[model samples]
Target: EAAVTQSPRNKVAVTGGKVTLSCNQTNNHNNMYWYRQDTGHGLRLIHYSYGAGSTEKGDIPDGYKASRPSQENFSLILELATPSQTSVYFCASGDLGGPNQDTQYFGPGTRLLVL
Candidate 1:
């Protein structure tokens, strides 16, 4: 089974401050993703990586950056936090299959508050 976990279940940041969220996966899956869940926006992908040392931008990559230094770790970086960035962040992991690999499992979530 795939297992992904995130740090600092909750966070509070001042506007314009830098915030970093970390993720770690025990599964050896090749795909790792970061998503933010908001009231009406739903879960929007912020970044993802196929494998170690490979970070790719996702649907809502603006105002966010990602790092994947190893297969077991991924990090999301917010250089200048904003009120608009306050949301619930989730880390997910799954193996990419050929034409059918789309199962994604999510972590509990990290609530970020920007003031």
Candidate 2:
């Protein structure tokens, strides 16, 4: 089974402060993604990586940065967090091919509050 974990399950930050959300996966999947889940907008992709040393911008990459330092680690960075950026963030890992090709295993989630 795929295993994924996130740090600081909940957080509180001030406006314009820096915040970082981290994720780690033991599945060794080649693709990793960062997303934010909001009430109306739903799950919106923030960033993703094909593998280590590769970070690609997603639909809503304006205020966030992503890093994949190794096969098991991926991080989402908010240089200057804002109130509008507060939401539940998720991390997922998947492979390009296999029985679970289109399936992504996700972490529990990290809730952030920007005041």
Candidate 3:
């Protein structure tokens, strides 16, 4: 089956540090997204890109950034990582299969821990 995967499945960071989560999708989809899964709010969109060389900040853009240099790769950058930012991050790639329906194939996830 087609899938999305993340690297450094687990991470530990100091109070003021930098962390980057990598993602790669092989499905050849046109859109890529980054999200954080946390309690209470569930999943929240942090960033997304359409095709290659284009990225947009999603709902929550504070303390985070994103890059989409090509169709198959997208990266999430945390300039100044903080403890509150610790959470499970996910990446997804997808395309609209039907009218008003966009199917996003998600990566397993990257777990991050901040001190």
- Top candidate, metric TM-score: 2
The lDDT of model 1 is: 0.92
Tell me the lDDT of candidate 3.
0.90
Q: In terms of TM-score, which candidate is stronger, 1 or 2? A: 2
Misplaced by over 4 Å in model 2 are none
lDDT tens digits by residue: candidate 2, 22-79: 9999998999999999998999999999999999999999989999999999999999
Best by lDDT: 2
lDDT of each: 0.92, 0.94, 0.90
Candidate 1 lDDT by residue in tens digits, 42-81: 9999999999999999999999999999999999999999
Per-candidate TM-scores read 0.93, 0.97, 0.93
TM-score order of candidates, top first? 2, 1, 3
lDDT tens digits, residue span 1-115, model 3: 6479788789999877888888998988889999999999999999999888998989998999898888899999998999999999999998866542598889999999999
After aligning candidate 1 to the native by TM-score, how far in Å is the CA of 5 from where it should be?
0.9
Candidate 3: where is the Cα deviation over 4 Å? 97-101
lDDT, candidate 2, equals 0.94
